[model samples]
Target: MRSLIRQGADVNAGDVGGFTPLHDAAREGHTEIVKLLLDAGADPNAVATEAGDQTPLLDAIGSGSIETVKVLLARGADVRGNDDAGWLPIHEAASRGTPEMVVALLEAGADVNARDAGNETPLHHAVARGTSQAGSVQIVRLLLDAGAELNAVDYQNRTPLHAAVATIDPSAELMRLLLQAGANPEAVDRHGHTVQDLARMNDNKMAPAMLTRALATARRDTGRSR
Candidate 1:
């Protein structure tokens, strides 16, 4: 790669899918190759001409390497840049990257409340993606602490709580965490399903869902709006 760069290779050349060498290196977490390409005048914020419009920073987050993320940020990667899916780097980190990655982006001044094409915030992605998995809860907390609107609605008019109760995580901890954070229990989605209604509908015939039981206890304990 260095030889090609030294030989005057067009470092920013894109492939058929509009993936440049910088995009490939960032996606692969090739920190040194990334630096080489950037030094050769690669556009850090260059969007793929394809439908996704992925920038190198977005690909670096997919690589899940904080070092690579840092390198791109230092090279002028824009945290606000969204993909074809309207997801920012912060949205990707909140949905799947490590907590450290989210923290780094936040420290770099990424917007906690930035909206996507669907108007979903990083908070929405943090709650909606995956199954309230191991790091997911922490990501949720980070967004909340950063002042993510607890009830920020998406294009579907669904809040993070709406997603938490509707998803099939089964742990119920995500819902509990949101409720404790002051999410409105009565918030409704575009389909008009309330958080409790979504929880009940999500219950299988085998037995009631853990989320239902957790919500019941929350209501009983706090006498919250039913």
Candidate 2:
């Protein structure tokens, strides 16, 4: 690789897919190659056509290479750069439930509440793609603690709580977390369906029951506080 560079190889050359050497190195977790490519003046923010305009940093996050991500960030890669789909690196991290990547991106000033093309936040992805109930719960907690909007709505006017309850594998506990974080149980979607309505529509028995109880508790608390 060094010899090729010494011979004046175009470090930023892309194939038909628009994948630069840096994108390949970052996606493959080749830390040394990534450094060499960046040192050779490869554009760190180069987007791959086949990957929906994903940058090297986004690829590194997708590959779950923390060290490679560090390398890209050190080279001044755009942490907030999004793909053509409007999915940011933070959104990918959240979708994969990689807390380490999430923390790293956040530390580098990634917006926890950034919306995708669909207007869905990282919290929405975290809940929608979470592999398990406990995993989703942890990721949700992380986002909320980092100041994610508890009631942020997507293009469909569905909040994270709404998305959570409507997921193929719904978790009552996840809904509980959102409610506790001040998510509005009464909030409706574009179709006028509330969180409970979504849960029932999705055949999620536990979530609706949990949301109802939480809503009752929240109402009582509000009444008392007033």
Candidate 3:
């Protein structure tokens, strides 16, 4: 690989997924291969046509490959690029609950509040997944600490709180966290339903009540934090 790169092989060549060699290495979690590609001038921000317009950094984030994420970011990867999937690297990281990737991207100058074509921020995606399998809560907390807007709405006017109830296990603790962080449950979506209303209809009993509490807390916090 080093020899090929030195011989002028395209370091940024893509395969069927629009994945560059860097993307491939990152997807495979090959830190050494990634280092080799980067040292050879592979464009960290290069998007392959086969990879659905996703950059190496975004691919790494989707796979939750923190080591590869670090390598790409260190090489000046654009963490904010929205691919055909309508997801930024931070969004992918948050969706997968890759807290390390989330923190790293933010620290590397990725916009925590950056919205995709759908106007969904990292925080919006983070709180949407109610499952405990990935680090959803951790991702949400990290976004909050990084000054993510708890009340930021998507194209549908759904807040992060609106998303938290859609996942499995319906993280009550995460709902509490977003509430404490000032998410507005009373804010209605494009469908004219509040986050609390969505939760109530979701078949998950715990999350709706928690969302209601969050709405109340948001009101209280607004009164007191002033």
Q: Judged by TM-score, which candidate is best?
A: 1
Of 1 and 2, the candidate ranking higher by lDDT:
2
* lDDT of all predictions: 0.82, 0.83, 0.78
Q: What digit string (tens of lDDT, one per residue) describes model 3 on residues 1-226?
A: 8788778899877667667788888877888999999988888888776657877887777666688889888888887677886788888887773778888888888888988888989877776666556677778888899899888888888887787865555776787788777666568889998766777788766766766676666667778878
Off by over 4 Å in 3: 3-8, 212-226
- Model 2, backbone clash pairs (residues 3+ apart or across chains), number: 0
Q: lDDT by residue for model 2 over 87-195, one digit each (tens)?
A: 9988988887377778888888999999999999999988786347335567777889999998889999999888887887776566667776778878899999987
Where in model 2 is the C-alpha error above 4 Å? 131-135, 203-226
Question: What's the true lDDT of residue 105 in model 1?
Answer: 93
**Which scores higher on TM-score, 2 or 3?**
2
Question: Residues 166-206, candidate 1, lDDT per residue (tens digit)?
Answer: 66554466777777778887888889888767767775431
Better lDDT candidate (1, 3)? 1
Q: Where does candidate 2 have its weakest 10-residue lDDT segment?
A: 129-138
- Model 2 sits at a Cα RMSD from the real structure of 2.9
Per-residue lDDT of 66 in model 2: 82
